[model samples]
Target: MKGGATVPIGLTPEQGQLQEAVGRFAARHAAVDQTRDSFEALAEGALPKWWNDLVSHGFHAVHLPDGVGGQGGSLLDAACVIESASAALLPGPLLPTVIAGAIVLSVDDMAAAKLLSELAAGATATVVLPESGDLSATATDGGWRVTGASGDVLGVRSAAVILAAARRDDGETLWFVLDPEVASASVEQRDGTDLTIDVGMLRLADHVVPEALVLNGIDDDAAWDITVALSACASAGTLQWAVDAVTEHLRTREQFGKPIGTFQALQHEAAMLLVNSELAAAAAWDAVRAVAEAPEQRQLAAAGAAIMAVAPAPELLLDALTMFGAIGFTWEHDVHLYWRRATSLAASMGPITGWSRRLGELSKTHVRDMTVKIGEAEADFRAGIAAVLDEALGLVNDKPSPLGDYDHLASGPQRTLIADAGLMAPHWPPPWGLGATPLQQLIIDDEFAKRPELVRPSLNIAEWVLPSIISSGSEVVQQQLIPPTQRGELLWCQLFSEPGAGSDLAALSTRAVKVDGGWRINGHKIWTSSAQYADYGALLARTDPDAPKHKGIGYFIIDMRADGVEIQPIKTADRDPHFNEVFLADVFVPDEMLLGGPTDGWSLAIATMAQERVAIGAYVNIDRAIALRRLAAQRGPDQDAVVRALGELDAYTNAIKALGVRETIRLLDGQSAGPASSIAKVATSIMLRRTFKATLELAGPLAMVERSEPAIVAPYLRLPAELIGGGTRQIQLNIIAQMIMGLPRK
Candidate 1:
């Protein structure tokens, strides 16, 4: 929500009707009970025939053109049916059918129409390739033998033709549509799901294929692109179906004394999953509609959407499963069906890592230029590096950050280009300087936030520390510190925590007794970010000896280069420290260095704390998490969609935890975007904890199924992260109570 597209797309009535129709179909047909057996059959080499029934009922024909023997409907219509079938766990050679239709659609003339027409009539059609283990017309004996065995075909036995990719002797890549039964090969029984469609090995030993079998008449690359696009659509459809099923389940299923769906945690999980489903849909939708966009752009967009897909669908399904507990995992339980579909669909499409690599490659070409990542702290300070990070409870940034990465900023009056547009400080009167309102200011912040690139420029952060100096220091100190700091004359680090002082802020024993014009400071701080680059720092000193603990502290802006100051980078679990450690041995801070009135430092510190919390919450990206869940949901049970669902849910919950911190940032800014952040933290934990609990519960006896490292890793990953982060659920509730509700703090 923080950086979502500002202008939303509204759907037409027809689209609404189409969606409803799809939903109705899912309601009537979704069945999870047979999911496991069917997938087991598929994995072992048998696929179901009921899948053929759905295909025959016009599932694949919904989107082909009228001349193609279809309803001549839109992609939206096709997707609706695909999604519905997925929700129901009906199996067909969907990959082949959709891929074939795509190849047919790419034809330049009546040939395409003819191909589509034949396929839409339920004639089995597929793409034959090395990717699918078959080749075009070329071989060792002069006639190309499409000699290869396709051990696993989603709907091969039912398919009259298959789409296969192969490398020619000259190394040219080609696709062919070959008939397996006719090929000089053996089709032997292999264990597959449900014992429906024949899942056999087709070993093409010198099997000849005709050049007419080539899908592409001219462009060799065309078929490949077609396959990618069509497969994306099918994957989208599968994910969407899982989303619908999970959404419905979340809305209806009850546990722990109420519909688990009603819980904020669950709803958020569902909401994120739904977002993923939308993304997958959007990817296919955009690719289909972007018949005009650049080929690479279209591919990138498709890849981006697909890459983020599977995790969300399956995650939501698994969440729903957990809510249903053991009943969901039972051979007779309804959830397994959706889970199975989700797993198979995901495995079929390829992994997210492949897509992410594509994304990273695309990013190299498309990343926008500007101050991103690092920024000058202030005017003339080129060495300065600054980025805004969300801090803990009661946290805040000392001033509006120096980073500006959002595109909209070029539209804003140049910072300092005009005195009217430039901001000086609380020092300048409203008449003499920028007089932006809180809302306007918030807009500036938001604009700075919503760039396609979310990071602020690293060149502008030289001044993040100057304002804190100006706010709480003496006149002499302000003159000595703020301006030069603004010029990047100095840098700063935060020396706040020690090993013992993590969340309990007031227990610090860092001493700095007043001695003449300066104070002697001694303490150790751990996990301070950016200390390696700082010339100065903000530190809290114990000033009061006998008064109440929190009230006796003083905030001091310190010179990092001061005598007795030391720094060390702290290593983290992931690796080297993003933050560092600082040890102070009787460091001297001049009297002018106190950040606020002595003992008033705690309140001054509150500003950055809240900002930090909200900033951290922004990572909660519910949308991102959901995208992943929907992806996992699209996988077929043949690939262990339920357990895969467990993996997906695990990923989604961690993502949700990041989002909750972002919401907290918003609340701290005084915008009541509902108590979603509070709700997010609470619900995320519950969803996470319960999702894992449900995983164990759903596994019933299978909780003991630690057959491999990967088998049970999903639940394990989801649970611990939920238990950690942002002061825990209990701590977050305390913030909500004390900060939002005016309740007494513990």
Candidate 2:
């Protein structure tokens, strides 16, 4: 397009073309719904014959270098082709074949070329061992014998050859190639939830390989990389399939005469899925590319993926299935195929949760590794913030304004300043903070809000538009848009949440059609905050109503100054004109203004919203709780009921807080949120309600004491407002009970 200097991640043109060709070839022979069914029916150890076509498709050798008789494709090619294969739920020996081939190449084994060539030519192969449960190869003799068996070998039943890792007498583990035709081999059958891998035990005895065949010893980094890479790709593939399927269903399927996806409960679910999807993708890429990154970074990335996969991905899929109702359970439905494969892959690699524990183990190694490197940006920032926070905190007695008591708004400006100082930039990319030390991110985050005059991020303009643009918009768009917006420069508004579909966003009927060189957007967006003062608006409009629900949506950055736009400010419970009723009679947005592609808007919106709701759950409720606690302290010793209530409140709050932390850790560890956050959000709201009730009772009839200044009552009045702000309390419970607990819906 213009001056072509852009670096496209790890993808090369030759690799791209080769991947496309391979995809076409594989698709021709790929397992269809019927083929998968047939494969499932075949008992014993037999794999479907179509698997041979995958070998012929050059899939197994896709990641191998040219010297190994491979197309010498790039890793991106491997990911792309494998993801496509996974989406179709293609069944065969590809995972094991490729993984084994990579293992062989990893150890610098020359025998890999011949075996990989055979695999590329259609002979399925499997990697039998990687030093046991910890994946560190162990003990040997007569060269290296395939002794202690590997239980997770997916293609063991079909492989004519297997590569097993065993340790030499020197206590070094090495890869040993086993020609099944030569060795005594047997595959143990096991049934598991995730059906993607037909897992079996590869039993081998007396199979021997000399020094030439013993790739690299146990300490070889390449062998571990290859194994981790394969497992990661499969996991990533499973996550993608689950997310895509759920998105499709939630968008099209109907409930209460509207698209079910428009529901807050569903959108939040989808948001969680999107976060897991992105983080998981990042982790997989991180692991695949870790061979090139610094040691600790690689380990950290893998840890991230394992954390996400264990909890959110599985929970999301199961939630999606339950959302789909009865049809999802049937064998004929393709949905179960993804569920089966996702869980199976997890079990195969000891699941994402186990990887996290592995990550925890790996974490120990990284502490020392960090000592070997220099990290100035992260170091300076942490030092700078901590020193400033501790020193300045003593001076922040209280605000002169009434906000000192009603901290919800009082905290907003300080939060904005902290963000301006780049503390909020931790989760953001390098342009923002220390791209390293994600662990320290949490610590600094608490510091940002807890510092005296405890301010939090502003609600309007900056929060809504800047992040949304950076994530999905082009470099050109971000350059023109983000800097100014981020500097508190340009004010923006969100034109979503119509009266017709407050929670059911995808059900919106606003239309945006391509016109001239750009788009003519004509839509009515209700419940829009800051729309009246907006310089720009983040608009979600229906691009193709004819297309499926989610498929038709488009995300656009619209100029609020455009002639046709009209905004009507709406007053809320606070008796202030905050949210706007925006009418886009006919607004135009060019190609440059669109975020990502047309359809990806749904995905972006979901991502943006998820971070938002979670942040609100984390940040917003704190002040309200603290205000209640402080007010309770001010009310002397006479209120027994309030005291007893506060006691139970402390106990419940502690339990809920602990649950929140663990659930967060689980999601972080690649496990599911499993209704934990949903429960937290609802409980927070409920507790706040209880706390407010106690405050009113303890006001000892002065609870009705009205002050001239309305701000005086804000501390007490704000709880009800927050309960309704992000998403309703009722929806959160429905999600917790239905998705997390597997309870029947009301």
Candidate 3:
């Protein structure tokens, strides 16, 4: 069976090209059948026939310095090659060799030069971190005597050299480069789970290592960090292969009179698999980037990758096999090889719980910066925007309320300053906005973020609705609504969801009969947020009942205060009157108020909903994480469980933010948000739920009472709204499965 195309995982155009090139090379030289055929040779400590082919391309030296006989590329460059190679299940010691190379390069450059040049010339090496072995080093004349036994070490059998860590008598760790051919050294091959690589135990009996071979600049912690980073990249690659294989199977394999991909249950599972794969790739990408650009953040990034990608691979691949059914269980299928590799890799990475605790400890002082870097050309634009923001800041009386609150509109003068300057919606067209590119939009956001005191006026629902008016509305509609909405003078609500139609907006039964010079609408809209205060609503009503459900709807701008318009507040479980039910009885909307053609409402609604999903996904709320950290701080530092929970939450939070950054980059490159928006919506909802639940658990008895603390109890109560609103989580998953995975629609 042919495989589905691998999902794109590059962060830049150059990296994308490299990924493609390496993928093609792997397909041509190290395909799955070849990898399978080499199992016997790999078990016998024999290197792959294509090992030289790979080294000739400088794959092992991509991350090393040019002076060290490397390709002078960043760690991310090496990661692209590793991920692509792992996707093909290439049989060899490339991963361990790179890990050993990175650790050696970071410490002893002179020693690394020789080792790296050898590696670039097709010599393989393996690293044995302290966690993977028990060894001791004693200082002696002109050398150190090492004696101990290493646990199962990957690629040790075929390695020309072994970079192993041994503890001194004082409990300090020392790293040394030991030649495998040393007189007293021996390698014992072990039957490991992964078939594409050799694993063995190394025994050292008073083996003398020369002083020059002893690496002084590295320790156990640093070595493991390097190991986790590279391992994560390889694991992410394996996950991508599994995803592509399963996606192909689902697309072609049929049961129950149709393709299994069309089933909603399978589609949801497939969508989640894709989401997790994206998260894994993102964590790996972050780890490599941190190694290249921010040394201080390497541990934190690695811990995140460990929790989000490396440690979870085994189970994720197992889940993929279940999706493949009985055929996947057979030994002949290639899926089992990936599962075995994932299991072995996860085991090699050690326990995820420890990584989670480490992450929490690191996060107390260091945070992974999520700021988008704009080019130097935006420096002047940023300065000018800073001036305007400063002026607006001077006009505010105290700090303004949050942006999305219905009753917390910015002051009239402040709104005028911001809207007139086109800072309210910088991505909008000229006059109303600067017609700013995505980069400029990021810069504007950065400027506003600097001055937390100057709150931009909230458009609320208008933020989602006005875009439709701008794109599909008549000139009169645009002029009448856009400016005021931008200035916070006109608030809007959505009249699309009704009692009969919530997720299925096209099935709306509201009737809009054409009358003299206008149309009369009669409908009931439920769960309409801010309808009580909205000046107008973006309404959908069926103008032709006999036509198809999606074809006869009309998009209209309904006046909330018109005759026969009634808004009844619906008290939520949180006891807040934030949602309302709007009743329209013969509410007349003039012909000019119609947004597009009579039957064009479905497309317009879809566009509006897409914007809504993107808007929702782009907003990352880490308030729960912040609250949990604060609560944990008050509870003292002895709570290891709380720390681990915080770390896990931070990992999810980072992944979500990375998704947002990826979406922004896509937009910057003039690409659509695509199914990633839906994936984001699903991910955000799950993260929020987990975060709030964790916070409440941390709060203990204080969270039991409704009046104990609004922060603790209110968010937990309002969690259901997040699930149901903006298309339910299940609905979003269905969309993702169909759109991104090419699963047949239910």
Candidate 4:
């Protein structure tokens, strides 16, 4: 976990610092062997040697309020420490202690002040809720007598305070704190799967407790949400460790004359590990943030995290172990410990099926709120942007054409209004755009999203091309093309992918010989979307044939209507003529049309492709998932498979959204965007393909019909293009493996 591209769990600077501090502390104080040594101590019902060191550093009370003798940080802050500590395999009751503290804090502030103070002062605790056992409470004069056999609870052996839940005879659940030293209460250490912490069972035989210790404000759901959130954080940390360990192993370990990571199969597998780790981290971050800042969103976030991160964790760890080959299976290696821990954590959550059902049921009524935070300084900017969108909405409403109509010529004025106001491409430079920062871009998106009817016209390929054009095009070219393109008058198509050069565009043989005042383009491009409707095309051709493949190309703007330019529609599986084969025979492009230097085409093309990937990756359509949810709801909950499928789809969809939010925050924080875009591209493609396939399966026999709900069948058939369009899934995986994981290329 020290080096290599570990997908980050903490997003902000402070959180990152906290993660680093905890990581450094763990490396120095709680080494791997130290954790291994703790196995015996833990089994003997004794605390790890590093337990006092950890407590002295204030790790246990990071999330408690300052008034409670704590540092007054959010749960996310605590999550950062937990993730880092778990990554180091720190052996103690850190997780359960944090969970117990958070649950108490969430219920009663006054009680939390005392309990949290004790925790902050180095006392340990554990929680035993109804999910783990059937405990019953009987009312007494001044206290309640509890009786039950509790399930195996982590940290119970060393815990001074026990947070237990019991069902009263009146069908009401009572939550109370019990002193483990009580005479009638018995604590027995149990051998468990994970060796990093002591696990024990608590049995109470009419053990009396003070009413003062009772937490009447908390219930089963609230406690469960808190547990899931904190557990998810620890899960993220362990998954991260596996990712880093496997990645480093793959990078250095060689087979068949190269690093094993160089093999495409291994690379793809490693890339998937990164993807899942990222999704897990995002889910964990979102869940903890919801617990800290958004009380209303707690249950949904927790359920989402449980399915997205916690449930798949054990399997994800197993996948990592498989990637490590026989070495991972050895007792000497650390992978098995993570697998056991993940398995125990998942079990502690009481089955993922229940979580999936809860998520599916929640999906029917609630959507996760993904709004970005707007700061005070940006209030004026947001207001101005909102006012512009309001005007655009009015203009859109006044239009004669009905909404959703197929009118290529409709809403021209509305598009111009938005584009002229710089709302269309606010991230672009001024005049054409506001040269907006990432925050401003997000704000603009927020304002526009508020008024969905005032749709800013899709720029088609121009959305991918215009950035390069603005960055490298001549001033005259920019003046002539950018304004009109922004207004949606100039639809553009990419002319890069040749029959033989689909993913490897540098291998393209399209030729463009320099003529006196221009370049004569003669080549062919296939799978060109919207070529027939495009007013212009961005062409990549070899300007110098003798030079290297990537070194001799030129990027030129071509007039799709120019002489010798031909567009032939290619009917795809969906039977739509959206794709076309464009052939150019001596199509003349003037000197100004050539973007950048002649040899700069490859770099420019790469930049465009990067932007393309980002755009495609960011555009996750959960509509299919919603449609499936509606269909599943109609079929009722009896369809467990449908419910599970819906839950899985919703989980990945939110994971993708979480990635988008993480990326936006990363950019806003002035950090490099990293490989998130590439990761998103791969994850989104897989999620979408699975979602459509699941829809078809859930639809039963009706999906086989020719006209079976065009909504479902159309996307199913059209998904292949998505896989191949921006960049093939394989290509994206290669990018992620190499760039993010630091794996060597073949």
Per-candidate TM vs. native?
0.48, 0.52, 0.95, 0.96
The candidates, ranked best first by lDDT, are 4, 3, 2, 1
Please give the RMSD to the true structure for each candidate, in Å: 14.3, 14.5, 2.5, 2.2
Query: Candidate 2, residue 366: CA error in Å?
Result: 5.2
Count of backbone collisions within predicted model 3: 0
**lDDT by residue (tens digit), candidate 3, 1-746:** 12443345566778878888787878889888888878888987898887787888888878888876788988878888888878878788999998888887777556656777777667899998985678898989998888999989999999998888888877888778888987899999899899999999999999898878877888577678778888988999889988898888888899988888898888888778888888887787777666744655778888888988888888889889999999889999998999998889988987789999898888777888767777675788889899998998767433343334333375477777888898877888977789999999888888888887676566667778888888887887788888878777777888889998778998999999999998999989999888887889999999999999989999999999999899999999999876899999999999998888888899989988887887777656445676667665665554777788889988877877776777688788887554567777888888888888888777777787876543678677877776777888899888777777778875
Give the whole-model CA lDDT for all candidates, comma-separated: 0.51, 0.58, 0.82, 0.83
- Scored by lDDT, the top model is 4
Q: Is candidate 1 or candidate 3 better by TM-score?
A: 3
Task: Tell me the tens digit of each residue's lDDT in model 4 across 448-529.
Answer: 7777666556565688999988899888888899888877667788999999878888899999998899989898899998
lDDT of 2 by residue, 1-746 (tens): 11111111123345446545654765676545545655553323466666655656666667777775676766656765665566556676677777666555544445656766666666677775545533233345545554555666676666777777655556666666676666365567666454544556766665556666655533344555555655656665666666566666765778788877667676666545544444444445445555546655555544444444333445656766776779998887777777766666655555443444444444333421111112343666667777756654443323222212433323333444444555545566655434535445555754564564654334343464567776777888877765555444466777767778876778888888888888998878886766776678888888888988878888889988997898887777556665678887878788888787877778767766655556556532353334334444454675334434444344234334434444444444454334445545665676677666665665555555544222234556545546765668766644543454333233
Least accurate 10 contiguous residues by lDDT in model 3: 398-407
Candidate 4 matches the true fold with a TM-score of 0.96
Error of 2 at 728 (Å): 9.5
Candidate 1: 10-residue stretch with minimal lDDT: 384-393
Q: Comparing 2 and 4 by TM-score, which wins?
A: 4
Lowest lDDT 10-mer window, candidate 2?
Answer: 1-10
Error of 1 at 286 (Å): 4.9
Top model number, TM-score: 4
